[model samples]
Target chain A: MAQEHTVKSYDEELNQLRSMISRMGGLAEAQLTGAIEALTERNAEKAQRIIAADRSLDILEQEIESQAIQMIALRSPMADDLREIVAAIKISSTLERIADYAKNVAKRSIVLNQSEHVKPAVLIPQMVELTKVMLKDALDAYIDRDAQKTIMVWESDKGVDELYNSLFRELLTYMMENPRLITPCTHILFIAKNIERIGDHVTNLAEIVYYQVKGETLDMNRPKSDDTSFAVVPPPANT
Target chain B: MAQEHTVKSYDEELNQLRSMISRMGGLAEAQLTGAIEALTERNAEKAQRIIAADRSLDILEQEIESQAIQMIALRSPMADDLREIVAAIKISSTLERIADYAKNVAKRSIVLNQSEHVKPAVLIPQMVELTKVMLKDALDAYIDRDAQKTIMVWESDKGVDELYNSLFRELLTYMMENPRLITPCTHILFIAKNIERIGDHVTNLAEIVYYQVKGETLDMNRPKSDDTSFAVVPPPANT
Candidate 1:
């Protein structure tokens, strides 16, 4: 009866950790969306909100890390239990980084707001929307422990990279045409880079989820891994 | 006698892990240096060498990861020992990413070699050297378990960022003045960004070393954590 009670307590703690991470992930996804909205819409107030809310994510990350440590100390968890706790810790860190990148994007929006507009870039918003979707899907995958959804998030990152590269070229052309625009365009460049980085972080979380579900490493950069059986057809090559 | 044997075996395993990581770090540092040299000197063969050698770093990373897992399974280490093994795994991943950035730099170097010279940029080479030194010092700090060296490496990262930002502005001017130079200049921009990323990774490794030694999180992005005693002096404001 005592052992059963201990197992029950462990499950409760694990569930609490998962819920906390899920809440944190939700907030991070919202932050990413708000950041993109702030930039694309030039809403300084929304950007400020995104930046201000970063403190909460930091606190949650630290709290979850401490809780994981305490649970490990108390339970000496093994196998799947141990993997889940470690995954929670890693996923929390990755989510916090995504929030940080979102905050960076918001900060850049503040800088870009000071200048007259460059031609509104279509790809930036598209990239932001895709990344936000990936962040949301990755969190959902985590909450449901669905490896397939996680894999979908991983596959979507290539699209983000293509968008970033195209944006880079577009910005390069703008800077070449008008040197005076460099300051504001540079800020915009960083905004795009931060969004791209958030996509990478979401991909990192997906890889962690893959590990939690499969007890194996998934190299998102490489095509061939143990999970190759689930590989989706490559998206039409981006030029 | 059994206790003594166990202690010796534990020490041996820890030392081997340390040795493997140090060698991996050394190889990664070399790869970064070679990649930068290839770009600045326009040596395609050197770039090819860096690209070819990256596979070894990937293999080393996997070996270290598996060894760490085996250690955890066989010994069930606790406290600092457990943290050290976990740190090794995380650091190996960071190092591998740094190697990937180096490969990217090398690939860009090959592309840049095909184009006409964009006025020879000197700052990027200096930035790469600083980052390489930081990686070496950070790894030394890890192996020696020296918090002081880790702190130094962390502080040095601010200088690298300053250099990177300055180079970004300068390159922007070059591309603007000579619009025809955009292709090669963009390649150089990526090279600079990759080196800067390598610096960031080294700083991350330093922070991990600080955590392993101090058992506390140090905010790398922020100048100070809640505790002011360890607050790093902010880099002089970039103009």
Candidate 2:
């Protein structure tokens, strides 16, 4: 808890806040991995567990908010210190959202496992693996406060968006070909979209870290590769 | 800008921040309405205009962020004033997201209007109307610093969720029944989902406003009516 700062108490409080955020990040990482495992293995029980565990994330968020508010009141953090506290608040909320998305994926898994298992659930596992790696790297970068690492993590989100776009088109094609697949396909779409969005939130953390460590927005244009909004899927008439 | 407090400069800074937020909120409200009107009138030109205007929201968000950081650095705001500045930052980001969703809806509308309009865009208009009212009230509550009004706005978001759930099922059914309709229906689903999320962001604003005014989490256990995660849509097998 002791840093190269004059005020030992302020350093300790910030350290406590850091550790809390790390714990929350660890929980979020576990949930992302756990939900995907639940989906891949069709373990409804595991999915249920992940869903149940989300309450902890919510509780942790409240704790972070309380601590951050208390720190602001007591320490009167300015400039970088204020930004640091705000980052914790924002990052915790992002982690909580990531946890919620993981829960949604798990819930979808419960329903997916019960229905006809026609789709191989192929791309999603790959996406889950990729996203988990990204999530891990993003958190690690945050803790290390390595601006370059954060920038790298931020760039990697484009890969997530591209993967999501491909999966989106693939699922829609299946739905258009086989109406029976629409219900399952739609759920899968949401799950994949959830993962994609989780990637976006992780990118947000990376940006916050970048801004905190370096006093500037990462990149002005922010090359977002999300093509989902275009709504340009072909009709698949030949099918 | 003039406050009864001794810090005249601080009061003016806070006032400037508030006006910036209000301007951003106004832009967001117009975007939501413009997107819907674009859909109803089947006007692609109007949708394009809405899409172009999103850059303004993005610009405003950055200004709000810079101003907030500068204020924290200069004023060393404490307690309520700190909360007030933080509220402006959070609310502006939410407004930015709402604006983005509206742009997405407009983008989808351009594609949807290009395709067949078999579904008549039924519940969407009602949902859009409902969300617009919630957003408006949420902004009003923020300006007034009325916790009661904020809570009312927060509770009203359940209606948006209910409407979204109903719209989700309807669009899915349409996609299942008409194979050719899959493309447009999917786009509309995203648009409706976008509007639903905007409502959630507005609820977030209400929560922040309540916290700023009351210095507590508003009543806890927010009553969310969203059951989309339940995944009990009967598989739409009969369609």
Candidate 3:
């Protein structure tokens, strides 16, 4: 899939950049999964691992930025090549945020894990899994230059939001029913929100990919169904 | 302050891009201010106006992207010129996100306005104003090539986080004390969160400006003090 570049080193430099993005994407996925598993299993040690690992993402982000800037400076790439470098930088930033969200989720595990070992929030695992898939697909599409795959990844964010809303209501119900539950449930609420934001960052990747490959913006608005518009009131007592 | 460019049109193009950024900044400021007003005053119409005005920010974002791409394509800009274009793209994107956060805050106005009136969440206006200043200073720093100004903006995000945490605890205390306050307070909580996110985006602007002006990354981690890291157990009832 190598294009006939007059200078082959240009292609090699871009490949190196892509590999960095790929590494960063993989680390974000691992951090997310580790955080979710820690939550579900009440494994504080695992959560700590996720937190400890976030530093690598930070390093990778810095590397990506340097590589991208160097590429632009050395090659003076135009059009699609310029867009690709820009997309790499944007993707790394989003991945760094995703890793931060993972770290947030992991930090909550120490508290939620110590508390009466209740089950993890039901929908969070599902939400995290969806984001993992979306993140993977978004990165894959970028590497393959596949616009259709990127859009599919983009469309999945709505599902994550719907799942998040359900989790929000369910957590609120728990908090209201048992005042003691408030502490743990609030942590779960934020962990879920952090995962939801990761989905958003993943969708951002999709947008960057689509633009990088197709040289056109995604004309459709992002699908968002956050339950914020719904009243946060618990159901009436009789119900 | 025009540098001697071999091509006069390059400076003109950069200036035009700067003007678009300035206009976009103005619109974002208006949206943030209008959203804050609607939340504080319970004016659904004003909230709706802010929501409607978000389209202009979106339009400006698209325009910036197109112009940046076109400039890069036609000029094959190198070194600092390339970085400036990339930075502009990044800043516009962050501005778009800030506007979306404003829209989210405005969206909450309907419910908060409809519910029985309550005093403003004590720190939200303060947070919004701080973000507005950070955002304004960040952009001004970019225009003036003022690394010092951008760093100042970067440092201010910690204060915004402190304000957000305070608003969070106050809202939660009110909701727990009176279930009737849960509904509006929940909306206020989100509005506060939205404003907090606007602050983060403003910090993003600061990062881009610092990089663009100094040709170096800000050598510090983002300041963060989110309460989620703290134990969720309500503070011992006796202060």
Candidate 4:
């Protein structure tokens, strides 16, 4: 009976860890949406709120880490339970990073508000919308232990990268055409880049979810199409 | 006697994990240095070599992760041993990211060689040198399990960010002066950003080391001086 009680309590601990991860994911998703909204609406107040809220994710990550470590040492969970614990730890950290990207976007949005809006700023919202879908799906996969969803999220990140490339060219062109646009366009570029990176992190979350469920690494070479690094836009003919 | 044998094997396993981390850290340091050399020398072949070498770090990270998980499950390590194992996993992943940044620098170096060197490019080596010292000390702290060294490394990252801020402003000024320099200067900007990010990750390593040694999180607020996000360099008066 004592052994059975101990097993039951260990199961409860595992459940609690899952819930903590779930809560953290929810917070991160909210933060991402809030940041993008703040950027598009030029709502510095909202951005500041999102920035302040980021501390919660960090605190949650620490809690998850300490809890996971204690569970590992005390319960000696094996196989599936161990996999779930490890995944929770990694996913929590990933969520923290995603929230950090959101915070960065918020910070940049505050700076962006100081200048005239660049034309390419419109593209960021579109890119962020797609990223949000992937993040939501990745989190769902985690909660449901659905490996198939992870595979789908993994395949979809290419879309985000492709959008980023086009935005990259457009921003560069604008900066080239009007040198005055350089400062604002640069901030937009980084904000878009942050969104793109968030998509990549969501893909990582998908892989972790797949590993937790399947006990195997997601071995597929993720299609990467972010070519902005090689991009060189020539100055306008007048220049 | 049997229990003693088990303890001895566990000790060996922990030592192996530590050595694996040390080896990975060494590789990361070498890759950072090589990437910078490739940038300064404009050596496409060396850049390609550095990019190719990044795969090894990824492989090492996976190996360290699997070994750490196995030890945790099988050895049931407690307290300090457990903290070290967890730190190894986290540190190994951070090292992998540092190597990824180096690979990105190498990739950009190849593109940078295609264009005439921008004047701001000269500042990159200085930023990287500071980052390299921090990386070295952070790794040394990890291997030595010296919490004091972690504190020092944490405090020193401010210098790297200050350098990066200057480099950031200089690049923008160059890009504004010559439209043609925009392409190359953008790459330099990103390369410098990569080095600055590497410095941040090294600071993370220091925190991880401190935690691993002291069994407590480093709570001191790190000094951050990177202000590039808010900078605005106007175009030349003639423009």
Query: What TM-score, over all chains together, does every model reach?
Result: 0.82, 0.90, 0.87, 0.95
Q: Which ten residues in a row have the lowest lDDT in candidate 4 chain B?
A: B1-10
Please report the candidate that would top lDDT against the real structure.
Answer: 4
Q: Which ten residues in a row have the lowest lDDT in candidate 2 chain A?
A: A112-121
Q: What is the lDDT for B171 in model 4?
A: 78
DockQ of 3: 0.31
Q: What is the C-alpha RMSD of each candidate to the true structure, in Å?
A: 7.4, 3.6, 4.3, 3.1
lDDT of 1 by residue, B81-183 (tens): 8888878887998999899999888887877777777764688889888988899899888988899899899888888887877777677666556556655
> If you assessed candidate 3 against the hidden native complex, which CAPRI class would it receive?
acceptable
Off by over 4 Å in 2: A1-8, A76-82, B1-8, B69-76, B232-239
Which candidate number would show the highest DockQ if scored against the true structure? 4
- Per residue, candidate 2 scores C-alpha lDDT tens digits across A20-136 of 999999999999999999998999999999999999999999899778866765666777888888788888988999999999899989888876675636889888888888888
Question: What's the number of clashes in each of the models?
Answer: 0, 0, 0, 0
Off by over 4 Å in 4: A1-8, B1-8
RMSD score of candidate 4 (Å): 3.1
Model 3 residue B74 CA deviation in Å: 4.3
True contacts kept of each: 0.07, 0.43, 0.20, 0.43
> Once superposed on the true structure, which residue ranges of model 3 sit more than 4 Å away at CA?
A1-8, A78-80, A116-120, B1-8, B73-79, B118-120, B220-222, B235-239
